[model samples]
Target chain A: MSNKKVTGKVWKFGSDINTDLVIPNFAIYMTREEQPAHCFVANRPGWVDEVQPGDILIAGTNFGVGSGRPIGDVFVDLGVFAVVAESFNGLGLRNCVNAGLASLPCKGILDAFDEGDIAEVDWGTGEVRNLTKGTTLTGQALPPEIQSIVEEGGVMAKLKKEGFVS
Target chain B: MGMNAIEKILAKRSGQTVVKPGDVVMVDVDTAVSFDYGKPNIKKIHNPDMLVLLHDHVVPSPTLSAANGAKSLREFVAKFGIKNYFPVGRHGISHVLVAEEGLALPGNILVNGDSHTCSSGALNCLARGMGPSEMTYIICKGKTWYIVGPTTKIVLEGTLSEGVFPRDVIHYIAGQHGDFAGRNLEWYGPGLEAIGMDGRLTMATISAELSVEFSLFPYDKVLADYLDGRAKKPFEPSFPDDDAVYDQVITINLSEIEPQVVLPNKVAWNSKPISEVVGKHVDQAFIGSCANGRLSDFAIAAQVVKGKKVAEGTRFIITPGSQEVMRQAVKAGYVETLLEAGAVVTNSTCGACYGGHMGLLADGEVCITASTRNFKGRMGSAEAEIYMGSPATVAASAIAGVIADPRVALKVKELA
Candidate 1:
C-alpha cells in the first residue's frame, strides 16, 4: 500500500442516495470536475461548497443504484476523501474502486458519529475510525485483488503501475 | 472441456491465455462511451476518439433544469475537443443511435456508461454497460477484467404467430427463464434468420433485464444483408467454433407460445394469461425505452391503437427510445395514430423509465410498461405498481384499459 491515510470530516446522509441523484441524469455528459459541482445538487443544495477536501460522505443502503453513471467520480473530483455507506449497489461499488476513492461499508459508523466530526480511513485495512468520536467501526475489508487496485490509486493507475498498458 | 460461444469470443478478442465460464479476465474493449454524466472524468482521462457522448435523458424534457444541464454539457464537449458528442435534441437514445448509425460492428466488444448499453448487442456484438470510473479506467488503460460467462444456447424456432413479435418472445423467455436463470442466452438455429434486425434488437436488449452477463447471435446472412445496405463495407459472419459446448441450452418454439405478458415484479410467470387480466383497471400505459422503443415497436403500437382510444381512467404515454426512431416513426405515420388514439408522444429520451422527468405514476396507480426495470419507485411513486411487456402488449393494454394480451388485437389489426 501507499501508506496514505485518508482523513476527512464526516458528512452524513440518509438511505439510498442513488447514482442518478448523486450526479443527476442531466449532468452525466460533463467532465469529472464539472459534474461534481452538481453533486447532490437536487437533494442537499449547496453540497459542493460545503464539501471540503478530505471530507467523507456517509450514507445508508442501496447507495448508487440507478444508471451507475460515474457519480462516484464526482465525489473524488470534489475532493471527498472517502465514502462510507451501509450497503451499495453493484455498479456503484465498481465505480468507487475505479475512481480511486476509498469507499467502505461500515453501517454502524453512521450511528456512532455525527456530521462535521473528523474520520480517518485506512484504505489498506478497511478500518474507518472516527477521530472526533474516538471509535472504530469494523467491516469486511476489500479483498486482496480489489485492494491491489486501490493501492495503485484506482484501476487505470493500477493497470499502468503494473505495466499492463501505457 | 470446450468453451462456450461467449468464452471463445471474449478469449479471442482479449488475446487471453485462458478463457472459461465465470472466469474474470481483463480484456481490451473495442468501444468505450460516456456522456454529460461522464464529463468530469472525460477531462481526467483526456481521450475522446474512443468515446461517444449522448444527451437523451434530461435534455428537451419537461424540466428546464434538465434542458439547461444538457446545454452546459454541449459547451463542455466543445471545450474538451471530443468529436463524438451528440448534442441536445440531436442524437437519440445512446443505444439506438449506436445501432442505427452503424457504430456497432460484428465481433467487437462494446462498453458504455449506461446500464442498458447491452442494447448494442443486437448487432451481434458483445456489448455491456459500465460506470464512469470503469469507463475512465478502460480509456486510460484500454482494458478491464470481464467475468467471461459460459454460454447458454437459446434457440427461438418457428415463425411468429400473428401479433406475436420480438417483445413477446422476450416476455416469454423472461417468463420461462426468469432473470439470471441462464448464464448466457444466444439466439441460434434457422429461426434466427426469420426475425428482422429491429425485432432482433428488441430481444437482445432485454438480456440485461434478465441479468445475464451476455447475449449474442451468430452473424448470419440476415445481419450481413442488413449492414450491407446501410454501410458500404463487405461483412463476414462470426459464430462459435463447431467444437464449442454450451454450459446450458434452452429451446423455445415461438409457435407454442401464445402472445404473452410478464406480470408485475417478475419476468417469468405464465400461470395466468392475458385473458385473465382483460377487465383489470390500469392507471397508466407506457410504450418506449431501449428495450422496446424502436421504429418497429412504434409501428406495432400504432397498428394496435388505430381508430381506438385508450380506456377511460388510463393514461397512455409513448417516448421513442431515440431521435432517429422518433423521426422515422413520425414519417411512418405511427405518431399521428398514437395522438389520434389519445396517447401522448414524448421525445426520444429515457423520460418515464428513469423516473425523473416524464410520465411519472402517482401513488396506488398501476402501469404497464415497455421499458426495462419494474423495481420500486423506478418510474416515480414508490407505491405504484408496474408490469413490463412488449410494445404490442403495452399498446393493447392501453386500448383495453388493462393488461390485455396482444394476440386478438394483433390479428384484428392485421385484418383491418
Candidate 2:
C-alpha cells in the first residue's frame, strides 16, 4: 500500500447520513459525470459547488445507510480523498472502497472537528489528525488485501493490471 | 472450535476444513447475479456458467439513459452467449428471481449487485451483496475475496400472535438490537417451524436494512420441499454444530411482538407500535418488493381487503415479486380480490421501491410501503414520508387512508 497522506477540509454530518442524501434519487439516471453536479442536491443544496477536490467528509454513525446505489462515485468523481465516520453501512463501505476512496471508521472523530476544520489522514497507518483542533486520533487500518486493492486504484484496476480481465 | 453455517460455507468454498472470523479467504462463488446497472462496468465475461443477468431495476426503461443501458446489456448478454438471462417481463426483482428459480442453492456462496441479495440466505445459502466492480471481477474470475465475519445467533422462541407477521419480528429485532453491521445473523430455534420459507425470506431480505451482510437459516424439510426439483443440483445441506461459537446471541420472543411500523427516513432503530402511527394520513400504499412481494404477502393483503373498498384519496398499488408469484396470485384469486378493492396491481419489477419508475411519490406525500427501505427520497421526493410495515398493515391502511392496524380493521370490516 502507498504511504500517501490525505489532507483536506472537513464536512461534518450527523448520524444516519443515507446514500440518498449523498446523491439524490433523481441523479441515479444521470451519467456518472453528470451525477457529481447533483451531489447532495436535496440535503445540502450547492454542496457540489462548495466542495473542492480532496476534501474530507466526517459523519456520525450509520453513514451511507441506504441502497447501494453507487453514490460513492459522486465522491470519487468530485475527487474526495478520504471519508471519516463513526461507522459505515456495509454495502456503502464496499462501494467507497470500490470507488478508490479511503474510508476510515474512527470512533468520536465527529466530536474532534467542526465543519471547515482542516484534517490530515494517513491511510497507511490509520493516523487521523485534526490540524485545526490540534488533536489526533487513530482510525482502523485497512486490511492488507483491501489496502492493496485501494492502492491499485480499486478492484477493477488491480484486476486489469494482473491480466485477470480484458 | 465448531464453526457456524457461514463459516462452514466459506470454508468449503475456499477448500479449507476450518475457518474463523476475520480470516480473509478467496471463495469460489456458486452463483453470481448482475443487473443492467452493472453492465457498464463489466468489460468482459470470463465465466458464463456461474453468472445470471437480469433486467429488473428499471424495467421497461424509465428514461433514455436506462433504455440505452438495457439495450447495451442485452447486446452484451447476446455477445457473450450468457445462458441464464432474464429480460424485462421474463423476471421480477433479481433477488426474488434468484430464490424462486433455485439459482442459489443450499450450502452455496452467492453474490449479487443489489444489497437485498441477502434474501437468498433463506435457502441456507451464504449470500451477500457486492459492489458493481466486485461483481464484475467475480464474473471474470469466478471468485472474490471476503473477510469471514463473526456470526450473531438470533434465537426466536414462542409463536407469533395474531396480526404479528414475520415483518414485525424483523422490525422488532432492528428496533431492539440495532443494525448487525458487518456480522452474519444466524436465525434458529422453534420459531422456524412457524415462519416457513416465505417468512424466512422476508426476514433475510430485510436483514440488509439492518446493515447485515448475510442472514442465514439452517436447512430443514420446509426448505427442501420448497427447493424440490428447483435446485441447480443436489447438494448436501449445512448447519452450525450444536457447540458452534457465536460472537453474540440475541433471543427474541416472537409472541411479544406487536404489529410494528418503521417510521419515516430510517429502517432500523426508529420503529414504533402501529397504534402510535395510526390516523396519520397516507396518500399511497404499496405492497411489494423482494421483502414482501411473495404470494403469501398477497394472500394476507387480500384477506384483509377482501370486500372493502380502497379510500378515494389514496392510491394502492400491488406488484408481485415474480411472474410465478403473479400467476399464483391470479390462480389463488388474490389478484381479483385486490382489484375488487380498487388496488392497481402491476407487473413484477423493483421500480416503485427504488423510485426508478411507477408509483413515485410527490412532495409532502406520505406512503406506507412493504418494501425494505424508508430512507429520505427512497420513493421519490425528499419531502415525502415513507412508513415501512407488513403487507397486512399496508392493505389495512390503504382502505383507511391512514396508518391503521390490520387486526382492528378486520374486526371493523367483520362488524360492517
Candidate 3:
C-alpha cells in the first residue's frame, strides 16, 4: 500500500466493454497467459500487442457489464496499472478487486483525458488528475476493509494468509 | 424505517436489527453453486452440504479444457465431500438445476459463478451472480459481502395475452426502460399468479440482461405449490412489509403486451414487438438455454409445429436445459411432435446456446433464438445475426423459414 498513486499513459475505451470482449469464450479455454493476447480482439484486433505494461485505462459507464469472466485477470496479465470507469457493473467491480487490481469509478473521466494522455491517480487521496488536460476529478475508492483485502493481494491471498483457505 | 425484501434478508442474515441501502454487510449464503465453465480453485469448502457443483457449460466434453473442467469437479467432489454433484448426462444448467432440485428456497441467499443465477430470485431468494474469486471466498467462508442498493417496485396487472410469453415480457421491460444497473427489482401484482414458475423463472433470468442484480418474485401459493414435495430442505418465506420503502415504482399491464423480439446483438436499446420484425428470413431457429429450456418451452414449441414440416433449409435446434426437463418433455410426448416436424432435438447441455458446439451458426446466417443472449459473436460467427424471441415464435419461424407469429400457426392456445 506504500505506492498509492499510479501515473501512466491512458488507454481509453467506451461503455460496456464486457468480459466477453476482453477474453472471448474460445480464448478462455487457452491458458490465462495466452488469453490476454486475444484481449479486445473483437473491437481492436491485435490491440493486446500494443498495451504497454504500465498503461492505464479510462472507460465510460457500465464497463465490464456482461458475463462473470475474470476480466481483471486479463488486465492484470496485460500489466495494466489501473482502471478508471465512469461506472462499473457490480460483478465487474468485485472481479477486479478480487484479482487485486485497482479499479476506480470516476465520473466525468472522459473529459479529463483523451486516449494516450498521461494521468496520475492517487487512490489514497481519491484524486484523478489528467496531466495533459490540467484537470482533476474525484474517484470513488474502496472502503477501508475492502481496500485492506486489495492490499493483502486479493481475497484468496488474504484467506490463505489467515489460514481460512489452503 | 421499513425495509424492502432484500434489506430484510440482508439484515436477518447479517444479524442486524435493520439495514438500509448502501449498507455493506457480510451475509451468510444458503447455497453456493458453481458450474464447469469457470470452476473455482478452492482448497476447502466451509460446508460441503451447502455447495452445489455441476458440469453444464459443455457437457460430454466438446474440448480439452471443458473435459478437464468436468474432470476436475470429480476431484473437487471427493476432496470437499460434496454430495450434490451433477456430472455429464445427469446435469443441467446450474440455474435450472438449482430450481428443479428444490435447492432454491424462499428467504435464503444463493450465490453462483454464473451471471444468470439471479433467475432463482423467482423463488423469493436473495440470489445474485458473483465472480469466481468472490464465489471462492463464499465457498470457503460461507459468506459474502453485499452493498445493498435501493429497490424498484414493479407492479404487474391484467392477464398475459395469448402468444405472449415471459421472454417477451422481459424484452418489453428492457426495451422501455434501459438498464437497471446496481439496483434490485421486486415484482408483485394481480398478474403474478398466472405467470407460473416457468414463466417467472424466464422473466427473472432475462432480467439479468438489464444488469439488474436481483429480479425477485414474491413467495406466493404458486411457488409454495411448486415446492410442496420438491424442496431439498425446510424453508420459510419473506415478504416485504406493507410499509416498505422503494426508490421507484413501475407498473406494467400484462394484457397489453405483445410478443417482443430483440434484434440481433443487444436488449437494452434493441427490443421490438413481433410485428416490427416479421417476415425476416432465418437460416437457423434455436429453442433452449437456461432462460426458456424448460418443459413448458418444449410444449409450446411442439404445439406451434404440430403436424407441420420444418422450413426446407432452416435448421431447427432444441437443447433442453437439463436431464430432468428432457425426461419430463419426453414423457409428455412433446419431443416426438418436435422430432416428427424435422426439429433436431439435442441432449440437455448448454452447447449451442453458449456457442460451444452442437449447432453453431455459419457466417451470413440468421437465427431466431429463444435463448439467453443474442449478442454479436454470441452464437458462433461474429457476422451471424441472432434474433431472440419466445420459443413459440422461434418454432413458428423455423416452420415458415422466416420469423413468423405463433398466434397464426397455433390451432389452439395451450398454457404450460
Candidate 4:
C-alpha cells in the first residue's frame, strides 16, 4: 500500500459533535470545497479558514448523534482528511464510512493532539502519527469491506464499481 | 455455541448457518414503508407494488392549499400501484395503521424510512428504522445487511398494578437498561397477553430512544383472537424453540411497578412515584402519536375526561392515530367525551411528537405527553420540557392541571 500520508493542521472538539454543527443543511446546495468554510460555523465560527486540506478533526465520545442529513454531504464537499474521535453515534459512523470519509476511534484523543499541529493519517495501516508531538496513536483497524469502500471513494462509487449500475 | 433469540431469528431469515454477535448478513425485509413526504422519492423509483405510503403526519388541516397538497399526494398514490396507501382523512399513524390492518405479523422483519419503525415490533416483527437514503437503497435492492446482535429477554410477570400502563412498563425498562440498549428487548411470560395489541405497540414504539434493535411480544391467544375476525392472509409463524438460545433473560414482576414517568431530556430517565411532580402544572397535554394513539388508548383517556373539563390553563390535544381508530372513538362517544372535557380533538396526524407541525409549544412551556422522545427541541423549543407517561397518566395530568399519578387520580381498580 502507498504511504500517501495526509499532513495538515489539527482541530479539536468535545463529545456530541452533532451533524448540525459539522455540516448544516442550509449549506448543502453548495459544492464540497465551499462547505468546509462553513463547517462548524455554528459552534466554532471560523473553522473554515483555519483548516487546511489535510487537517485532522479530533472529537470526544458520542460524536455525531443528531439528525444524519448534514455530515456525509458536508464532509465530502469540504474534503476533510480524517475524523478521529473517542466514539461515534451509529448513524454518524455509518454515514461517514458510506461517504468514504476516514474515521478512527482512539482513546484519549483530547490529551493526545492539539490545535494546528500537523499530523499524518494513514488509512491502510490505521495509524495517526503526530509529527510535532513525536507520538503515534493507533486506532481500530478498518474492516476490509469498509476499507475497500474508502479506496473506491464512497458508497456511490463503490456501487458503480461493483456493477450495481452503469 | 448457541445464538440468542435475535441472532437465531435473523440467522434463520438470512439463510446463515450460525449468527454471532458481529456477523453481518443480508436479511429479507418483511414490511416496507413510504409516506406523503416520501412521495417524491417514490416517484423516482416508480415502483408502487412494494411500498406502504401513509399520509397521517401532514393532512394539511382545513386550508384549500393544504387540501390541494393532500390531493396531490393522493394522485401520486394512484399513479403508482401502491396497495397500501392510507390517504389523509382515511388513515391514522403508520404504526397504528400497520397493526389495525394486520400487516405486522409475528417474526417478520419490517423496514421503514421513518425512525419510529420499531413500533410495529408489537406484532413480534423485527423492525428497524432507516432513513430515505437507506430506504431508497432497500427499494432498489430487496434486502439489507445487518450485524446480528444478542437478545435481551425482558420478562415481566405478575399482574400490573393499578394505573401502570404499558408505556410505564417500557419507560421503566428503558430507564433500567439505559440508552444503547438497542441490542434487543423481548417481552414474554403470562403477562404478555394482558397488555393487548395497543399496549404492546406502546411498549415497542419507544424502544427507538433506547437504541433497541427491536421489541417483541411472543404470539399468543390474545393476538390470535384479535386476528381471527379480521381479514385473513398468509403469514409466516415463528418462535424460539424450547432449546432456542438467549443471551440473558431478565424477569420483572409487575406487582411492584407503580405508575412511572420519564423525566425531561431522555425517554429512559424513568422516575419513581409520579407524585413527585404533582404540582408541576403543564401548559399542554398531548395524548396521541404512533406511541399511544389507538382506540384503546383513547378509551382510557376518556375515562379521565368523562365529566371534568381540562385544567383552565392547559391545552389538551387528542389525536387517535388512524382513520379507523377515530371512527371507533367517535362511535364509542369517547371523542364527544374529550370535547366536553375542553380537549381539542385534532386530525389523525403526527403532531407534537416533533416540532415539525401542529401543536407546537411556546418557549419555557412544559408538556406532559404520551408521545415518544422528550429530547430537547424534540417537540418544540429546547426550553420546553416534556414528560412521557401512559395515556392514563396524561389524561389524569390534564384533568389535575399538573403532573399526576393516574393511580391516585382515578383510583384505578386492582389488576385481576
iRMS per model, in Å, is: 6.1, 2.1, 1.8, 4.7
RMSD of 2: 1.8
lDDT of each: 0.72, 0.86, 0.85, 0.71
DockQ score of each predicted structure, in the order shown: 0.17, 0.58, 0.57, 0.20
lDDT of 1 by residue, B1-416 (tens): 56655666688777874587646566777667765443433334425565677776665645565566666666656766667777766767788777776777777777887777767666777787787557766766667776555567887678887767777787777666655422566779767778988888878877666656667877778787777756423333347767778777888787776666666533434324455556567899998887778888889899899999989999999988788888889999999999999999987877788775778888889998888766555677656777876788889899999888887787787788
Question: Each candidate's chain B TM-score?
Answer: 0.92, 0.97, 0.97, 0.92
Residue range A1-166, candidate 2, lDDT tens digits: 4475899999888888888777677787777788888777767888888888989999888777777678667898898898888888878888888878888878889889999999998877888999998999998776777767777788778777777666
**How high is the lDDT of residue B150 in model 3?**
80
Model 3 clashing residue pairs (backbone): none
Clashes of each: 17, 0, 0, 8
Q: Compared with the true structure, what per-residue lDDT tens digits does model 4 show for residues A51-100?
A: 66666788876566544344764666665778878766555665676677
Relative to the unseen true structure, what is the C-alpha lDDT of residue A21 in candidate 3, on a scale of 0 to 100?
Answer: 78
Candidate 1 chain A: minimum summed lDDT over ten consecutive residues — where? A157-166
lDDT of candidate 2 over B208-313, digit per residue (tens): 9888878999898899999998997777778997789899999888888899999998876889988888999999999999999999999999989989899989
Candidate 2, residue B73: Cα displacement in angstroms equals 2.3
For model 1, the superposed segments whose C-alpha errors exceed 4 Å read A1-66, A69-147, A150-166, B1-3, B44-47, B61-68, B229-237, B266-272, B414-416
User: With candidate 3 superimposed using the best TM-score fit, by how many Å does residue A102's alpha carbon deviate from the native?
Assistant: 1.3
Fnat per candidate, as a fraction, reads 0.26, 0.52, 0.49, 0.00
lDDT of 3 by residue, A25-111 (tens): 567578877888888876778778889988999998777777778888889889997899988878887888888888788889987
Kindly report, for each predicted structure in the order presented, the TM-score of its chain A compared with the true chain A.
Answer: 0.89, 0.92, 0.93, 0.84
Error of 1 at A10 (Å): 22
Question: What TM-score, computed on C-alpha atoms, does each candidate reach?
Answer: 0.76, 0.96, 0.95, 0.83
